[model samples]
Target: MTEPVAYSTVWHVVSIAIVFLLGLFFCVLIGRKIGIGFRFSVFLYLYHSFWCLVYFWYAGMHGSDAFAYYNQGLLGIDRIWFGSHAIVIVVSFLTSVFSLSYLGVFLFFNFLGAVGYLFFYSSLRCASIGSKKWVNYLIFSVLLLPSVSFWSSALGKDAISFLAVNLALWSALDFSRRMSLMYLAILLMLVVRPHMAGLLVMSLSVALFFDSRAGTLRKVFLGAVFTLGAVFLVPFALDYAGVKGGANIDSVMDFIDKRQSITKGESSVDISSMSFPVKLLSYAFRPMIFEATSVFGLAASFDNLILMFLFIYGICLGFWRKLNPEYGNIIFIVFYLFGAWAVLALTTTNLGIALRQKWMFSPFLIYLCLSYINQRQLGRLK
Candidate 1:
């Protein structure tokens, strides 16, 4: 006679199987709904799953905030909203309701991240409809970047934030029809990072106000709504982001100084003495091959190299001229991307933090660059 299988082990196995099935189902369903090919969606899901495992291994070897969240979930959470606490609440529900192990939770977040990739791909696919074959290849290359998958595949803020950002981007492609999704994205970002929600609101408000295509009445109505949202959210976001004294220059500078001082580590740099341009450059493209100290850093360095090449390519191709001021979504992306980029560059003193957080804005930058390239290609044909 054999001893009974441990309930914990059995539950872990069952939970993982369920999560995988659900992930596959949703991948196919969403792919069909979004008009992306089924095979490509499956490929994206599997690739993201592979990175999830990599993240799991890295976490086990080096430790991660994910384990803390999972342990807290096992103990249970009292709050269901706001910041990291919200993630803890989600973990609690998943573990308590489904009896999922840590690996299952990782896979679940991987599914969310995969959905984000699908949304991003769908948005780019729409933009690249008449683009050349090379444009498609470039877009595919961006989708396959390992850093985006690895950072977003874990049970942490990055996955949720990536989903929210991509959802917002997808909705922005057809803002009038998909305003609900924009709001949903804002709420998700608000729960995890209020400042980002504020930035989104503020950017959209400015874009709506300047949208030449909209009638004056429509512009006024939507602009007023989003402006009020920004008004309310910006103050709350400022507080949440540790700018206690408010949004004045002094307060902002103090906050930056505080961040630079507090975020000390092996990867930390003294950006306090750096010029604004240098800070932005460092935040977006550092950890170059020579600077990389670990396997992760080396991987990130390669991604940054691609981004650098894309930036130079965009400049050479005059992609900026391709942007139409008439398109409100273009304006919104520009505002949000640069706004987030500058803020993060100034505030994030640690290269490791910069690496994970850069995705918050980098996807938009990629979209803009790709859209411009696609437009250029179509123009050449015309």
Candidate 2:
């Protein structure tokens, strides 16, 4: 039974790859018909090249998550329970193959993440505020953010979650225009990473709030949101039900209460000493003392100055535009930024990523900034 499961998983993977590649070919053909530019080509090529390195790295299985999966796959146990969404099955099956080689796992993660980058760059094109040269400079420079590469370089879940969020937003923009396809696409993606899918849920909720023209049935929206919200809560739900693999749910609850009890006003550093996770919380928010400690991650958030500057400028622009009556892309931007912080604030891992995650926020910031600037430029010409 186990061997059959393993074999079936492999066949499904091969079939999916063949389909995806064929789709990419069609995309390219259509893109050429529409005259896609050289810069997009170069950007994609570079993205692929980095993943190529990642894919070639491990002959042996790696990734903390992959390790658990590899053993399970070896035992011929390949399925995990979830809704009708194919992503749940795909992720599970790939976890089996990813258990085979280190590089393979990262590559798979990279591939899923590339979906989000597609929308991100598209949105950027929609919002580019600077000259072509400045846009190109911003584009290339922002890619250097460490966390961006780190996700592609490791067998981590962040890349795919990131992609799902982007697709949800991209579809949100097109929701009224094509409700069936866009809405289904958003739900399929939301299912892929419901734990971090909050960004999509939150963004779409705001999108729903402002979207008076989307004359959908009220039950449809309510049902979709409620279903996805329950899925998002599943991990916690399972923990509470005592269906566990890694967590000591009771300990976690106790720690949370303890942290709340002590930090009357975010004081009491002693509370952090209570556990490794709490220690991570301290490092996440505090200044780095580079010479003395290796555990706190970086001293402060967003260590890259140029990228940080671009991000801040972009965010300010997004907020200002969101406040304006025109092109309410600002609301989505606000929601994403707010969601990003809220997620980070949930737990602290000293992964040198606090500031780096801010880099993804950079593109959004710049897009809003450019839109405002360019509109003004056109106004001046008029």
Candidate 3:
């Protein structure tokens, strides 16, 4: 009698192959749409997959949130359309319908992250057009950073949020024609994090209000729409973020205090005592190499070092002085970046959380800095 192969082993092997093939197909398709070379897209997909596997191994060793999400999905929770529950629903569908193993789920999320990388890379390519060699190098360095790929590759909110942010960013490059994409991106963000969606809408509204390139009638129409959106979204977002008392100064301060007090650990800091600038710095650029206590911290520190250098370089080059008010997209991104960063910095008291969450805004800062450098290079040539 022939020996029977284990069904679990067969399922695992088939799921892995399908996920890998599907990821490559999507990568190639998105690359073609974005006008990137196939080889580069494949390289990026492979690189991101490498980090996905790394995350899988790490999760197995550490018993991470990925396992929690997977286990919850196995319970067959009733599906919800938005919030963190949506991620569990996705896991449920994948496991119940597709019979994907845990490794398969990680690969699937890794593919989503790779798609996001395509959008991110396309946005930077648009912004860096005509930039000098060094600017391109810096942009590549940012893309190659492991922290982003690693955190976003597992079954969690981070992968979906990263995709939403990048999709929004790419749509902002040509906002009028890509308004549908922007709407989709905002919807996706709302599903994961309503507060981020609220911030994105607020930023777009402010940018449109000041956009010289937009017609007055268009501005008026959008202004009303955005006002309605804000009225609905802001309160919901505040409630979700644990600011139940509303947007008053006292409420916000209370929320911040609560956040600081609750998030205690080895990586926690006394953020309540820090000045506003220091708080921002700590959230965005702390855990420098000297302060790093673990291998992961050391890696993050190196990435931060690069980011710090870019910030200083942009300032030294007077990047802010070169901003043009007509580019409403730039204005939109700047407002989004600052607003998100400020809120997160105020609420995040743990370096580990900051490390994982800063990707939500740090990429915007990086794009802005690189765009400014590219513009400087173009000016010198002219």
lDDT tens digits, residue span 104-201, model 1: 88889889888888888888787677777887887888788899799989889999899999988888887878889899999999999899999999
Top-lDDT candidate index: 1
TM-score of every model? 0.94, 0.60, 0.94
Q: lDDT tens digits, residues 1-382, model 2?
A: 1111222456456654553454345434433433446456345534643643543343132324434443443445435443223333454465555432323433455555554555555555544434456665665555544435544333344454555555544444455453453455445444544434444455656656555554578646754774576456645533442335523677556544543444433322332334554443343333323322432123233334444465456444443532332334456566665555444443323333343344334444445555555444345311
Which of 2 and 3 is the better model by TM-score? 3
Clashes of each: 0, 4, 0
State residue 352's C-alpha deviation in candidate 3, in Å: 0.5
Off by over 4 Å in 1: 1-7, 268-270, 324-328, 380-382
Could you give candidate 3's per-residue lDDT for residues 254-352 as a string of tens digits?
988888777646655556678999989888887899988878878999988988988888778775574543222888888999999998888877888
Task: List clashing residue pairs in candidate 2.
Answer: 129-370, 288-299, 302-355, 314-365
lDDT accuracy of residue 244 in candidate 1: 74
